[model samples]
Target: MAAGDPNHVLHVARGIEPTEALAVLGAKPGLIRTCELPDSKPDEWTSLPCAALGIQPGTAAALLAGRIGEWTFVYDDLGFTCDDSATMALSADGRTAATSVFTINADASLLYAVGGEQVEWVNVDDLNLEEDLPGMPAELRAAFEAAGNVPTEDLEPGEADGDIGMRAACALAGLALTLEDVRRIPLLVVPFG
Candidate 1:
C-alpha cells in the first residue's frame, strides 16, 4: 500500500503486446513514456523511490508492463480507476483479469472479462470464500480457496484481507511475479492519463 507499490494489476491474454494493452487502457502511443527498470533486483523495483523513475508522487499516472507466459501483466503504482466499458474493451479479443486494492480507503475488487464481456466482479474483502467462491471463475475460485488457508502469512505488515484476495486473483490470472521473471523481462513504462 506504499506509494510505489502496485495498487492495480491487470492481465491481458497472451498475444496482446504491452503497447497494444496500453492502447486498450487509453494510453496514446506518442505521449507514452518509456523507462528501463533500474539496475537492481526485480523485487527491489517496486520499493525504489518513485522519484528515481521521475514519477511525481500523488500526481503522475504511470504503468509498467511486461509479457509473462500466457499473459501480459500491467502494474500501476497509483490505482487507475477504469470504468466498466473500458474494462470490457481491454478483453475484447481474449481474457482479462484486473485486481485493485487501495488499503488507505479499504477498497478493492477483482474483475474478470472475456471476449468483451464481464464474467465476474468480486468485492474481495467482503467475500467469504466458503460462501462465494463457487460463483467465481474456476481458476480464480481455486486460487481463493488455496489462499483461504493461510491468508496473511505471506503478506507484509498492515496488508488487509483484500490484498490477499487480490494477489490470489492476479496469480491465478498468470501474474505470479518472481524475481527472475522480472529481471529478464524489460517492462514498458507507459504514461497514462
Candidate 2:
C-alpha cells in the first residue's frame, strides 16, 4: 500500500532469489517488519525468512491487486493467538511452498506423515478451482476460521508444529533447497498434495 502508513501490509513476492522474489511480488522498498528464528533441533519445523505480515485496513485488497497468481504466498499476523502466523517459501529455482492457514491444509496427522517429503512443482493457477476451496478438509477450514482477522502481541514458544508447517517445510525441500537455507527462513512451506 502507501508508504509509511504504519498499518500492516502484505509483501507479495515470487522468485528463487530473495531479492527477485520481492521484486516479482512488487515489494516497495520500506522497513517491513520481520521475525528472527533461532536454530532448532533436528525434526523440528524451522522458521521462514519472512514469517508473519502485519495486516491493516485494505490489506486484503492490496493482496488481491498484487497477486502474481496462487504462486504468491500471503503472510499476516492473526490477533487471536500467539501462534497464528503464516507465509510461503520461494526457492532459488522458482519452486514454492506455502504455510499460511489460507494456503495449506493444517491437519496434524497429515503433516507428521509427510514431513520432509517432496514432489513435482506445480503452478498455483493450474490448480482446479472447482476442487480446491470446497474440497478443503474440515480441519483446515476450522484452523483458517479460528485464525481470524486480528493482530496479537502475545508471545508463544516453540516452532510452528502442525500439519501445515510440515507441509510448508516439505514444499521447501521439494524446491531442492539445502536444510541450512531452509532453517534460516521464516516461511511456511504449504504442501500441494
Candidate 3:
C-alpha cells in the first residue's frame, strides 16, 4: 500500500468506537499529532502535505479529504510492546477509519481487522495461535502452519508482494474462497511490535 493510504481501513457500521478499534490493534498514545475538523467541513482545517508527514500522496489525500470531523496522526515510540508504529485516522463519529505503517516491509507485514462480524488478524508469515485470529477458517490453518518461517528476504521479486499475508488475512476475515483469492478488502498491515 502507498505511504499515505492506510494499510487498512475499517468502516464499522455499529457498536464500536474508532478509537476502540485502534486500541485493539495495539496502538498507544504519545507525542502523536492530530488534525481535527468539523464533521461536515473538510477544508475548514488546513491540511499538511503528505510529504511533510513522510506519507504517500494518496494517503494524504484520503486522510485529508472531504467531510471528516477529525483526523489524528502520529509515529513515535509510545511504550508499545512491539517494534511497530503507524499513522492512524478516525472519523468524528468513531465509525470510519484507517491505519498505515510505514516502517514494515512486505516480508514482515502482519494483517489485521476488527469491528465487523468477526474480529480477526494474522501474521502474513507467522500467525500467533494464541490470539483470537479473526475470520480464520479451520481448513486454512494447516496451510499457514505448513508455510512456517516464510521470510520475504528469501523470496523472488514478485513472490513477496504480500500475497501470503493477504491470503492469511482473507481467510481469517472470511473474505476468501481459496488462498489465491484477492478481494478488495481493507486490511491493517501491522508489523510485530
Candidate 4:
C-alpha cells in the first residue's frame, strides 16, 4: 500500500527502536525475527509465506517498523497494536499516537496517549464536531481540522478522510512517509508468533 493507504500506523515518541516497540507491544523476544524487504511494499509483507519463513501459518504475525527522527513508527496490517493497553505501554516513556483506517467499512480512529495515559480518541469522520473529541489538545484539534479540509476531488481513488487524518497525526508526531520512503527504507520486517 501507499503512504496514506488504509492501515494502522502507530507512533511512539522518545526514539524507541523497532525491537523495543515490539516488546512494548508484547511480542516475545525469541519469536521475533527481523528481516529486510528491499523489493516489497509495506502491505505485501503481511502475506509472506509463513512456512518459508520457518513460522507456522496460524501463529505468524508481521509488522514493519522503523525510527524516524525522534519517534518510532510501527505499521500494522491488522490494526491490533492500537489497543489501550498497548498504547499505554508504548507511551510509558513519553507519548504514543495511533491511526487506523478500514476503508471497507469507513471506520477510522485516532488515539493519542502521553506518559502512559490516554489523552484523546476520536473517529476521523467525526473530527469536524468539537463535541466528538473531548480533551484533545488545541494543536492536534487544529491539525485534524486542517487535514479534513482537503478537497475530495484532490484525493486519489482509495484515499479518504482517514488517510488524511493519519498523515496529520504522523506529521504532528514527527513522521513523514511517502510511497517511495516505504519502498526504499529498510524498515525492520518484524515477524513473530
User: What is the Å distance of residue 13 in model 1 from its true position?
Assistant: 3.8
What would the TM-scores of all predictions be? 0.77, 0.25, 0.28, 0.70
Question: lDDT per residue, candidate 2, 31-147, as tens digits?
Answer: 332433334322212112211222232233222111222333333322111111222223223443333222223222211111122222212222232343245444433333343
Candidate order (TM-score): 1, 4, 3, 2
User: Candidate 3 — which residues are off by over 4 angstroms?
Assistant: 4-18, 25-105, 109-162, 175-193
RMSD for all candidates, in order, please: 4.7, 15.0, 12.2, 5.2
By lDDT, highest first, what's the ranking? 1, 4, 3, 2
Which predicted model would earn the best lDDT?
Answer: 1
lDDT of all predictions: 0.61, 0.29, 0.30, 0.57
Model 4: per-residue Cα lDDT over 41-77, one tens digit each = 3343333323224443335445666777767777655
Give the clash total for candidate 1: 0
Residue 77 of model 4, lDDT score: 50
Give the total clashing residue pairs for model 2: 18
Q: Give lDDT tens digits, candidate 3, residues 115-150.
A: 222223344344443342334555345434433334
